[model samples]
Target: MAAGAGQAPVVTNGIHTAGQPVELSIGLPHNLGTRIHLHLTILATSIIVFLSSATLDGAQAGAAMSSFIYAIPDRYNPSQPLTTSLYTQPSSQDFSARLAKVLVRRTGKLCYVGGSMNLANAVGGGTVDEEMEAFRAIVAVVAAEVTKARNAEE
Candidate 1:
């Protein structure tokens, strides 16, 4: 669904895998000033089947996945930015987390992960490896930048 002006757009989609309904929604807010806001929610009929063989049980896997979402703002930094705040809901049960990570940038250009559909692809199997890999790939470029910034300070 389209968000109102000065608001973030909301994208919702779902799929059925292994006889389970998996739903995902991502919200991207605009003009937040030195901070970007992204909200992600994943819901499934059976959390286990939806997430596909995750090593952790429902709660653990949910928390872990939540962390991945919270890391996005920092992982995808925008030029010399100072701080990033992230909020996420990886599953039902009122489970959520907020993360704020410090960042320093050396480049003028901004980088963000496109093709959020990739996340849906990973959700099909719900395997820990699959999910983490997708999460890692999303942040890999920014992770490198963060590392470089840290090294420069040392």
Candidate 2:
């Protein structure tokens, strides 16, 4: 079925403009530990692979994450299957700023958990009696960088 053609559920915290664009997505927090854990692990891996600096580049990552949410139609519900984005036009800088702030705010716990896991990996040796040690070392290093980056935000 078409997006706008369907009746949108009334959302109070953030209302969708009747004529505005929307994008349907499955927000990550709902994942079972397997998916979320693997996802954070992958994100940590990517950060290690691309990051050259010794600190957490929160502003850079936070800004990028925030910019991702601007959108198309109103058919999006956090509980459903991911949908294609409905783009009507570019969002304003103010909107983006608000979005970024919200993103950064929302990221508080995920960021903390990732950082914590990184630390655990770092101290657990390059090879664990139970798991891969190299990943932990990598995680520890990334955690330090992220900590440095996240601290900079304060």
lDDT of each: 0.27, 0.24
Taking all chains together, each candidate's TM-score versus the true structure is 0.24, 0.21
lDDT of 2 at 39: 20
Task: Quote the lDDT for 134 in model 1.
Answer: 33
Model 2 regions more than 4 Å off: 1-131
Instruction: Name the lDDT value of residue 138 in candidate 1.
Output: 22
Model 2 RMSD in Å is: 19.9
- In model 1, state the lDDT of residue 122: 28
Which residue window of length 10 is worst by lDDT in model 1? 45-54
User: What residue pairs clash in candidate 1, if any at all?
Assistant: 51-126, 52-125, 52-126
